[model samples]
Target: MKAAILLIGTELLNGAMIDTNSIYIAEQLNKYGIEIEYKIMVRDVIEEMEKAFAFAKKNVDLIITTGGLGPTDDDITKAAIAKFLKKKLVVDEKEKKELVKKYKDRKIEKKSNFKEIEKPEGAISFKNDVGMAPAVYINGIVAFPGFPNELKNMFPKFLKFYAKENNLKSKIYIKDIITCGIGESILEKRVKDIFTEDNIFYEFLVKDYGTLIRLQTKIENKKKVEKIVEKLYNKIADFIIGEDEERVETNIFKYLMAQKKPLTISTAESCTGGMIASKLVDVSGISASFKEGIVCYSNEAKIKRLKVKKETLLAHGAVSEEVAKEMVEGLKTDVAIATTGIAGPGGGTIEKPVGLVYIAVRVGESVEIIRKEFKGERNKIRQRTTLFALYSLLKMLSKRYDI
Candidate 1:
């Protein structure tokens, strides 16, 4: 089924608040075979809400609205929806009693307090356990609250009810193949033949580390999609890291932990700061293999903490390949990564411009140092350098230890 999302709030329209409801709703609807055709954002104006409703109803079978459900005068979603459906607004007595008793006990009773319990005539109201305002369903419109926590808690009930009334078979099947150490254009060229197939579609989401290839096909073409995925694996299996929600860091953590005698890993970071270590710690239970993380941002810290030679720093500077190699080799661990770079809007010379990074990865006796000149702001350069450092270590580990 096709759907439309009408987001109502002045805060969202004026960029005072981000509309995260649409993202969550769209993802959930896609899982249930609903195609979201239009996403309309309107302020707290009744005329605008009605117009959005008219536009959505003409094109979609289902319309979901979020926001402007409260006790204040500006909370007009319930009224606007009632007007659009040409229905009378009525107070829900049970909800009104709940609100009245709670407010009366707190000595804060007002006429506006009952507004939270109002709904369109004959519309089905779903109680919100987390908030005061309740959600309503009428004429194929499901009105939910603006509060993210309340909406997230209440959406599952609506989904369960909707599933009972509609056929919820998924329309599309999606597969994600995440690849590291390979750019999108190169990866696309390697598997360009798969694009000629009529039953499937491919999309590439480029990331700082690598690319995420999203492959989709109609539900009926499931078997054919598997064959195509196998074909892609055969073509670019070496570059592929993990699939779906897995990232390079997670893959590395898993590989490190799965070894017979799990290898301990450490990091000595310069331009990337502690980002490489921070990402490693994000994975749960990674402490089993993750040993230490040191930030050697200054030349003295590099020399004192990681034993990077002062002579090497004076000869080739702190951001050079020589210092990066020494930093990685000095780490007391089975596997180590070191990053040094001139990630900057400043601190760059003619020879070593901004985004000039040297990453060193050492696994046992083997050490590899690579120099890359990336293009971006300081944070972007640091982010890319962190990913590259991790990817370098992952590559070496996979090749030497076959993890």
Candidate 2:
């Protein structure tokens, strides 16, 4: 099944507010095997909204609209939708009584906002658990408020209802792996064959650290879909590190925390700065697994704080594998991850060019260092380096514990 989303707000068109509803709606629909083909944002104008409704009805099987359902003057979505469908505006007696009961303590003048309960004729209203504006369900258009909290509560129930009514079929299984020293384009080419199947869908999202590829297969026959996922899993087993809902940092933290291991991690960063530390702290329960993180950006700081030798800095400069190894060893943690390189718009020589990063992981008695060169903007390089550090740590922990 196919759907189109219509977002109504002048604020969204002027870039005053982000249209995040579309993403939430699309993801929800995808879970039910509904594909969202087009999304359009329009101002609170009657003609434009009616035109959008007409266009959606002709093209897609389902139309979901958000915003413009309040009691204010600009809240004209209900009127427009009713006009487009050639229906009369009728007040719902039960909804009006409920609205009045909610504001019985207040004066009648203050209860004016409750006028929103007067929905169009023949429309079924879905109660909003979080807000006052009730969502309206027509034949195809499902209209809800623009507020995120309200939409989140109402949209799931709406989707569940639609799925049961339409008998849509959807199945999702995700396989994820952490890989270092590889780019997305290269990874896509290597795993291209797995993406080519009659009932399979593929998406690759690149984060600061690396690329995450999700393989989704939908088949009426559940057994066939499971078999295809198994076959694809075997083909990409080597590059795959983690699976559905398990992130690289989460997996590493779980492994360390389960072992009751006391670990202190630190960073000797030149390019990545404190991004690595920020990411590590983002995971909940990280305090149990992580001890400390140090950001040594300057040469003096690296020499004084991380105990990197001055001679090494003078000889190999800052972006070298040797320096990265020394930074990891200098930290007082059971496991230390270090990154040193040039994330550049400037600061590049013939010998040391831009996008050159060296990462080191130290655990117990063994230390490993790997060098990579990434091509992107400054933030991109920093993000890639951080991801690489996490990948390296996961790899080391897996090897040591035989996980």
Using TM-score, give the best candidate's number. 1
Report residue 255 deviation for candidate 2 (angstroms). 1.6
CA shift at 28, candidate 1, in angstroms? Answer: 5.0
Task: Look at candidate 2 and tell me the lDDT of residue 79.
Answer: 89
- In the order shown, what is each candidate's alpha-carbon RMSD? 6.2, 6.3
Candidate 1 lDDT for residue 92: 75
Off by over 4 Å in 1: 6-28, 42-59, 64-161, 401-403
lDDT of 1 by residue, 1-403 (tens): 8999999999987879988789778867876788899999999999999999999999999999999888899999999999999999998778888776767666774555577778999988777876777889998999999998789878878887887778576677877788877777888888888767786888998865568888887788878878888988899888887787688898888778778988899999999999999999988888898999999999999999988899999999999999999999889898899999998999999999999999999988899999998888889889888887887777777887655
TM-score of 2: 0.70
| Candidate 2 runs further than 4 Å off | 8-28, 43-54, 57-61, 65-158, 171-180, 183-216, 220-238, 262-268
Report how far off residue 365 is in candidate 2 (Å). 4.0
